[model samples]
Target: MPLTTRRRALSTLGAALAGAVALPAGQALAAERTPPVRPLWRAHAHNDYEHPRPLLDALDHRFGSVEADVFLVDGQLLVAHDAVDLDPARTLESLYLAPLAARVRAHHGSVYRGARTPLQLLIDLKTEGASTYLELDRQLSRYRQLFTTYTHGRVRRGPVTAVVSGDRAARTPLAAQTVRRAFYDGRLTDLGSTEASFAALISDNWTSHFTWQGVGSFPDAERLKLRTIVGAAHERGQRVRFWATPDVPGPARDALWGELLAAGVDHLNTDDLAGLEAFLDAHGTD
Candidate 1:
C-alpha cells in the first residue's frame, strides 16, 4: 500500500484503541461522581425490634446502626422492647444476630455495598446485666470471626461491632474481658470520665428541649455545646451519636439533623431513612 494509505490506516487504528481505553475510564469517573452508596452520618434505627419488619426494616431503611433490646429467658436471648413482650420465636440470634452474620458474609462484612467500615450493632440488654452479658458473650463467640475487634487503638476488619447499651453494669465487666470482639457504648455524662479503652461510640438522647434548628442559623450557645460534646468524643478517637432527637415530620427534624451534621456528629439517629437520605443528598459532603 502507498505510504499515505498506510499512515491513514495507522491513525484510525490508534483512534479506535484510544476510544476503547478511554471508555472505561470515563465510565469509572461517572461512577465515582455518583452519590456515595452509604449515608454520611450513620443512620440508626432505635428499638429496631419495634419496627414491623424488625431486622429487615432496619436494613431496608439503610440503618447503619441497629438497636435490639434483648432479654435473657431460659438461656435464650429474646428480643423485645420490654420483658413482658418477649417472644420465644424472636430470639436475638434469630431476629438479628444470625441474619446480620449472614448479611455480613453476603456483603463481605459490611452492611453497605462496597463499605469498608463495619456497621454498628447496638445491643441494648434488658435482663440482669451480668447474666445477659455473659450469655451475650457466649452467643457472640459463635460469630467471633465476624465482629470488629480492637486492641489499643487499632480496628480489625470483621463483619460488625457489637456495642452494649442500656445496661451500665455490663460496661465494667465487658471491659475486663480478654475477648477481642464486643465493646461498650457510653453515655454523654460518661463522655469524659470513662477509662474503658475500647468504648467504640457515645450515644445519648437529644431531647426536644434542646434547641438546634437547620435554619442555617444555630444558636451560639447550643452550637458551642454541640462542638464540645463532639470534640471531646473525637478526642478519644470515638464517634458520637444521639437518639430521641426530633422525629417529627417537619422543620424540627431538619433543624436537629442540620445542627448534628454541622457539629460533626458521626451518626444521626433517624427511623426515617428516606427523609435522612434526601437531606444527605441535598447537603452531602460527597
Candidate 2:
C-alpha cells in the first residue's frame, strides 16, 4: 500500500475514535442542560390515619402531604377524624410523628427521594382549640428538630411542615405564640382581608357550583376567579389548597383539578390517592 494512503486511513480511524470519545461527554452535557424534574405537588392523604396502613399507605402511594385529625386525650395527641373516634394506639406520634421522624433521619431530613421540598403534615385540630394546640406545641417541640420552621415567610427544612386546619379559634393562639414551627391554613375569605396573622397556606372547600373542568379548555370566568384567589394568597406568600371537591368518576373531578392547575393552586386535596395520582399524571402535573 502507498505510504500516503496508509497515513490517510490511520488519520480517519483516529478521527472516528476521537468522535466516539466525545459522544458521552456531549450526551452528559445535554442531560445536565435538561432541567431537574419538578417535584409533584403530592397526592395529599386526607384523614390518612383512618386508612388501614396510615403512614405506610401514604408512603406507598407516594403522597407528599398527609393529614391526621387529632384530639388531645390524656395529654396524648390521638389521631381520629371525629372527636369520638379517638384511639389510644393511634396517637399522633405513633401513627405519624415517629414514622416521619425516622424517615427524615433516614433520608437526611427530606420526605421524597431527591426532594428539596419538605413534605407537609397537616394536623386538623379536632379537639378544643386552645388546649389541643398547646399540647400540639409541646409534642411538636419534642420533634422540633424534625419540622420545617417559617418566620416572616422564610422556610427551612427540619422534618415536615405542620399546618393547622379545622379549628378557627386555634388561629388566635397560634398567632400569639412566639414559637415558629407550626403554621395556620386559613379559609379563602381570610386571604385578601386578614392581616399577616401567621398563616402559610389558605385552603377552602371546592363546591359543585365551581364550573371549570379539565376539558378542551378552562372556562374564562371561573379561571379568572381562581386566579384572583391564588394571586391574593401568593401575594402574601401563602400557598392555596382546596378540599371537599367532587371525588366520583369522570369529568367533574378532572375539571376541578385542571382548573386548579391552570390557576397555579399550590396543593390539590383528595381522599382518593390513586385517583389524584392518575389525574396529576395525565395532566403532566405530577
Note the Cα lDDT for every prediction shown. Answer: 0.76, 0.77
lDDT of 1 at 113: 53
lDDT of 2 by residue, 1-286 (tens): 9999999999999986753323377775784465444445646888788778997787766777888898888998888877678778889888888888766654555665457777888999887888888888888888888887765645665658888887777888788766577888888778876543367778887764355445456667777888998899988878888888667768867877777787888888777877887777778765
Superposition error at 269 for model 2 (Å): 1.4
Poorest 10 consecutive residues by lDDT, candidate 2: 207-216
**What root-mean-square deviation over C-alphas does model 1 reach?**
13.2
Local distance difference test, candidate 2: 0.77
lDDT of 1 by residue, 1-286 (tens): 9999999999999986753323377776774566646534367777778878887876765667788899889999899887778789999888887777666654544666577777778899888788889899899888787688765556676757788887788877787776557888888877878643577788887763355545457778888988998999989878898887877668867877877888889888776766776777778641
List where candidate 2 sits over 4 angstroms from the true fold: 1-39, 151-155, 193-197, 208-219
